[model samples]
Target: MSRWFRVGALASVAFVLVVLGAALRPLVLPEAHTAASILNAVEIGFAQDMAAHHQQALIMVQRLDRGVDPTVLRLAQQLSDAQRIEIGTMLGWLRLADASPLSAHPMAWMHTDAATSQHHSNTSHANSDAMPGMATTAELDALAAARGHNAETLFLQLMFRHHQGGLAMARVADELLTSGPVKETARSMFQSQSQEAGVISVLLTQLGGQAPH
Candidate 1:
């Protein structure tokens, strides 16, 4: 009799819990299973193109094969590290959104149309450059041929301009991307890159070099 009573009590508790779960399922399920927001063109474009942009930077920074001032070396190392991490972050967002990592036309998302594109200050990005502050193959070749101070100077100029261009992209991303992770990453980039640009400016002056026109 005692065993039967215990079994009956356990069954009754399980039945009540199941009933309670069914009653609350409607209230709890939707949010629990909510889908991630789809990443729009701007989000996808920024991720794809910016990853390429940073990859170029990584390439140039690595080209400083010869020794440089401690400061220059440290700056290049730090910038490259940050760029690598951010590239990874962008790629991660793209993966989550199930989007491609490369945009064939690159800046297609930055253009509304020819006339409308002119209204955008950064529309030069639509040209053959693919991105602002991107060093051409010729320029990268020049940088690779340089050594010591010349290489350091050229790298400084290139990276400073690159960061400036990246800041423009980050501003656009912060404005246009709806994804929280995308915007948050852009905002953080805006903050850090601005500060790094200031450091670059100081370094350039200390090196007796000026930004490329």
Candidate 2:
């Protein structure tokens, strides 16, 4: 995609962020949601899917620290800590709404056709599996075995793709989810991950690595 296209996309996201922020006055209060006493499909799906997505990121970050350059290690730690905290937040949402942590159909929350949902559910990167940026089992195995400069480059490559995929989902959540907390959280992901992906792209080139295939 062109840079202008990307900018326009994020601009739309920012508009949604502003809309959601206005919505927060009424929506942020847990009491308001508690009175509603039920979670909608979008809310349930986002929390469940995103929590699993965050878990895979934590697993990937753990491998980025050892035998890597200081810069890469710092980024790895940053990702680890941020993702861990976000995971807690997502789980808290699930608990607050008394929803199950796992859903039977993974990307059904994404509102795609039945064929797409089945495809996502069967994708093996995770159990609740339907997110674009998750590493496959073989890729994770390669990540585990890598070290030194190789590890740094591979990690940057993988994480760049990961964040891009994650941004897509976050933007979708911003559009689809009604809950204030969920929208705020998704907006944060959209902004943070967009910035992080740019950084990762630079780092990958600095390390003489190719962009994600």
Candidate 3:
């Protein structure tokens, strides 16, 4: 597609971020301590990391070819739109918690594995680009340069793997968070991404492309 479409989508996303910020401002208590107490490290970290993860999905969408099959384009658009709104929501939560939107230790909040702390310690310096389901700079570059059926197959494959990784984090969040808006959101993400991943798999198969390992 033309650069104009990408610019317009980004512009819309910025407006959404503004609206979400406004809506969440009232949720912050006058006392920063109270706000901090309400949101624990796990909640804050999940929001931070997931927002970054969702941003990548938008990048993939923006990089997609303009002349791909309508089915692929429509799915990409729908997923991107949903994830963009989710990114706004997550950033709003970070604002309420007075936490940085960027995670210093990506995936460190996940305590599912016994070696999680050790994993964080070992990978701390390089964790920024190491989040689950994140595309490498090379992979994104390839996606940006690809066109037509090649782009469609690659997008579906990459996105399928991306969704799998995201769903893993969501499941962990849902398991760890007892009750709260974040947990509810995590559960919602898990459900939605699961369904979306299944559709992506079907589409990838129809395109004669195997899901990436």
Candidate 4:
């Protein structure tokens, strides 16, 4: 009986040890590696570029705010708020990545000469205006002069183009950059803006308008 009691006690102690080991395994072991860091890098780049792009859109919307169309005014306000918040978030990612938000060459990370060439070609002609998705001095002036539904229509049209330009930039970021906060931000932007673009499309239809083909 004494020997049996000792054996049972040892068995109970071993069982407790096993349970303790299992409980502590997670704390002692390293987590599984993942692409989270890589995604973060993409996010940072996406944020920076998208912020700059949104800035242009904001400027255009501000010019149209003086018009009398309530719908346009409301939409402009929404765009301004959403983009401003997103810009701040992107800037934060830059800080996290130790990257400068104000790089000398904007959109340099894109590495696509085609985009740059297109921007330049559009502005090459003496009378040609700023690139598409960019507001020119004359176009802004015209938008400022307009009022009522015409102003609303114009604002929607310009904003639609601006969003499309941003979408393209986001796509490039998603494809190219790897690692860090930039990648994560890029993925987020890709998902979020894609959805937002759809919503914008719906709104355009409701307003008796359509996004450029």
Candidate 5:
């Protein structure tokens, strides 16, 4: 065979091997299982809403990426990474269950009469645009423009409230979601966010700033 032809044949063979290797690669997907009877429509709804809730927390931490305070910047980076991964996990659950992330209203899943009885009596508001622990666009804008200690203070305060809000949702998920994966996730959220909240509280005190009310 001609040298040029031999080289072309080898190149074709290599290309085919690469294509077959890619085709045979395993697709890593979230596992799915049958939902417990207690994990009814409400549980699914709660998971969907909470996933959206976590997304806002993720957004808030991302804002601190541009911040100037070393401590605040570090916390923000850590929070963002952690929540981003959780958000993905929750989103995978929603997809597996054929649930929608964009719910009709924020916290709608926890709006049932029975669930509401478990908490203080208050009128529920239906705001699809709002997440439980989210900073307002105005507040976010201010944080983005701030520098130095002021930025650190604001980031901590916002994050403190953010974690509190997440804990509330996590608590609800713990009480409501009954399936194995759902319960496991809710419990994990409760534990992780609760721990992070404590860390933030200490940092707030160290920074000479009060935690959010």
Candidate 6:
């Protein structure tokens, strides 16, 4: 990661985020304000929680060593770009709906859905700190301190587990919202994350690292 390459990468990321944000603004605004119906609790809650979930993903990508394998860097770039756009989209919905961008109760939204309740029964007492598959503070610290292959392996393992948790939330949202932009978004998230997780698994195996339990 020469200084020039680092600068170029940052610029590219910024350009993508700006372009995607502008393109998505119309899609998020129309239903939010022009539609006759209001956004339901499920929709609002999902946006809030999932946005926060995606924020952590950006952090994981940032903590990765820039000197790692090019393949790993490319994957990180893809995930970061996609999730940054999604975070913007989710925040747009929250702004239009007059909802908080952060969920005060985190996964508490899942409790309203019976299916989610049954599926996450073990997490009845979960909080933001207990969100499934979130890397602990110490874990993140370790990742930041790691270098080269070590950082790459740890990132893949952490991100793989993070996707699993977020995918669970998206699945619940998809099932709970019968028809809405939120449901559609959740379904898309599930599909995209599932594919990314698979690729991550293969990469982790190649790096001789097991996905974190």
TM-scores of all predicted structures: 0.76, 0.74, 0.77, 0.62, 0.72, 0.78
TM-score of 5: 0.72
Q: Which of the two candidates, 1 or 2, achieves a greater lDDT against the reference?
A: 1
| Superposed Cα RMSD, model 6 | 18.7
Candidate 6 lDDT tens digits, 1-213: 599999999999999999998999888766455555367887888898889889999999999999999999999999999999999999999898888898787777677647456437433324533566677789999999999989999999999989988888888888888997889999999999999999999999898998765
The residue-level lDDT of candidate 6 at 175 comes to 83
Cα deviation of 182, candidate 5, in Å = 1.1
Report lDDT per candidate.
0.81, 0.79, 0.85, 0.66, 0.72, 0.85
lDDT tens readout by residue for model 1, 22-133: 9998888855666756787777887998899889999999887458888899988999899999999889988988888888777666555442343256434545335777
- Clashing residue pairs in candidate 3 (N, C-alpha, C atoms within 3 angstroms): none
Give candidate 3's TM-score.
Answer: 0.77
- Candidate 3, residues 99-125: lDDT per residue as tens digits? 899998787787546335433443323
- The residue ranges of model 6 lying beyond 4 angstroms of the native Cα positions read 1-37, 121-129
Clashes of each: 0, 0, 0, 22, 0, 0
Candidate 5 lDDT by residue in tens digits, 66-127: 63667667778888888788778777777776767667665666766665553232222244
lDDT string for model 4 (92-196, tens) is 767766777765555555545654444344232232122235556787787777787777767777777776666666656655665545556667766876776
1-213 in candidate 2: lDDT tens per residue? Answer: 699999999999999999998889576754533366566777788788888888888889876648798888988889889999998988888898888887677766776554344434433344334577788888888888998888888788888878867876777777676568888898999899888888888888888997774
lDDT of 1 at 148: 86
Off by over 4 Å in 1: 1-37, 113-129
Q: Of the candidates numbered 2 and 5, which has the greater TM-score value?
A: 2
Model 5, residue 166: C-alpha shift (Å): 0.7
